[model samples]
Target: MNSVRTIFQDGGIYIALYAYLALAMIVESIYDNEAFSRWTARAGMIVIVLLIGFRWNTGTDWMPYLRVFYTTDSSSDYDSVVFGIDQGYVLLNRIVFYFSDNYSVFLILDASIAVGAVYVFIEKSTRLPNMGVYLFYTSYAVTHFMGSNRRMLAIGFVCMGFLFLSKERRIWEGWPRWAVPFGIAATVHRTSLAGLAGLMVSRRAWPAWAVIIGLLACLGLGMAGLPFSGLEWLGGTLAQYTGISAIDKLVFYTSGEAELGTDVNVALQAALGVAKRSSVLVIFIAYMRFGNPSQYAQRLYNIYIIGCAVYFAMVGSPIFQIISTYYSIVEIVLIPIIFAEIPKLKVPYILYLLVVPLLLLLTALIPYLELYVPYRSIFSTF
Candidate 1:
């Protein structure tokens, strides 16, 4: 059937991306040259651009975003916040709308900005940029950006700031530096606040035992049937910025009307997924114990640990899980640094080179929360 063909064709591209990176890694291992690695990473960008930029109607929000593109006007006051959209995003959309009405243009532009930002962030920030790109394509790209249109753009800007702050770690050059990007991200999605919270807390040194105790407490609360309905205030506050009213938001969260709450089955799946992914944390730990990383890298590792702690503590709470995701973006830089430094490891590097790829490949085969599945696109369908 044509539907099967579409899934293969579209999904094949992702598989090919994994293959391409695997081949590149093998080559890098043989040659042991930086030039090959850099060029390969740059080449990978071209593939990503093609894969993400050309696709149509593949993401869950594609039609909704298309409708938004058609409906949004360039003539409106740019500074005035459109209840559902960020001011900066509104301005960008209006500017794009000025030139043409085709929704594809917006898609192309968005894909470019997001993909390009990740590329630059990885290339400039990490020694093994290729690994960063590979992890991004396999782990985060389509699932995060394609379906969720606006927030990913904001996250891109936040990523840009994150890279910069990784290099320079002061108020003049660090967290304060990310303020503007974080502000922009908040406008695009209220979830940006979670990222900001992670960044702020990441600077402090939280004891491992204390973090463990806190996690136990949260999990205990979940087991006790807390229902988490009390957190409806947060949703109500977020609704103030969106077109949706507070009463509707309350109903949705409290009544289980929205696909917002997680049952035990979902939580178990999430726990397994987290455990699989958190295996990468071992590499970070190895690096810290054996090799001396730059201060920025250490800071990032700290943030990653904090993120992991938060995730384990709140695994049962979907609201808190969102917060954990924002923090986990540290993996982009962390994974690569771990890989590049594997040579200095006291143990054999072969285990990681074999295991990571297999894990990512397996994950890619699974559907992405019903948001990105079967990989439908206008290019293939029409």
Candidate 2:
């Protein structure tokens, strides 16, 4: 255990996990057997839950959430959640504490919900579940499932809700289906409302050129800080009258009191975001226009493109990225689908494997490695 802890402290655990995912991708690609693909996906999901769920002291919020767990009890009032955390999350703490005050259990429950929902969606919706889970793990393991517990839970519900939106056609069937999950998500994190972008893009299929032009325009808007400059004042005014703690929290962040991650070189991040998002967008849109894309992929792709627009448009806002994340999470499954459908040629496949890790390195690790590296699991310490 001490040796394992040392390895984690050296960041070898992350390297190993990345290698494991790469290996799984290789096997699934080569074996061409249903059982191997299914089991490989299952193994990957279990690894994600265990690694992230049992993380002892990691990232920024470990001690704060631990403190919350320690203080919470069955009688804890949801309305009085500290710092205006959602009632749904406070209730979750109460329920967990009712059975056991062990914080590890709470963490595991969170990992189950956050990781499980996305993986289940991938499994149910995509032909390449292994690749889908790989994308989810690589993209968000540190930033989300390891950091913001409530936001992750909310994202879980949104991911599941998308399943309904992507599949159902009837207004009566689809709206209610997604709304139930969306309601649950909003209770956990108000930003989960960003999931509505999925519904918005679902209304009509815009032309390829239109979305591209719109995205570029949003980039310009963000550069000038048009909407966000007013957003702070607007958020403050709404918080005063509405008395919704969520709005208050939003006001706090946007007011420059707490960055919660908005403090950065906006222009650089936005440009890098363009490189990352546009790469995926090009692949997805190409398939939509030139190839035979399934209705599910088409709808989800539209949502993802809107998510990119949202992110570009709100690059300078404090909490806007959180909103954009709910919309962009669609890519976990979308990218894998696009990858799986690539022509059976070695060059494209090899380039994909090379490009994905490079992209993650550029967009995620370069920016976030220090915050969440030296991955420390409770079990490792033992």
Query: In candidate 1, what are the lDDT values of residues 327-362, reduced to their tens digit?
Result: 677787776776666665413553565466555444
lDDT by residue (109-215, candidate 2, tens digit) is 88888888877788878777777777777777656777688888888889888888666475565577789888999988877886776775654456799998998
Q: Which candidate is the best by lDDT?
A: 2
- The TM-scores of all predictions, comma-separated, are 0.79, 0.89
Worst 10 residues of 1 by lDDT: 75-84
Task: Report lDDT (CA) for all predictions.
Answer: 0.63, 0.73
Regions of model 2 farther than 4 Å from truth? 1-9, 73-81, 174-176, 203-205, 260-267, 358-371
Query: In model 1, what is the error at residue 204, expressed in angstroms?
Result: 8.1
User: What lDDT would candidate 1 get against the real structure?
Assistant: 0.63
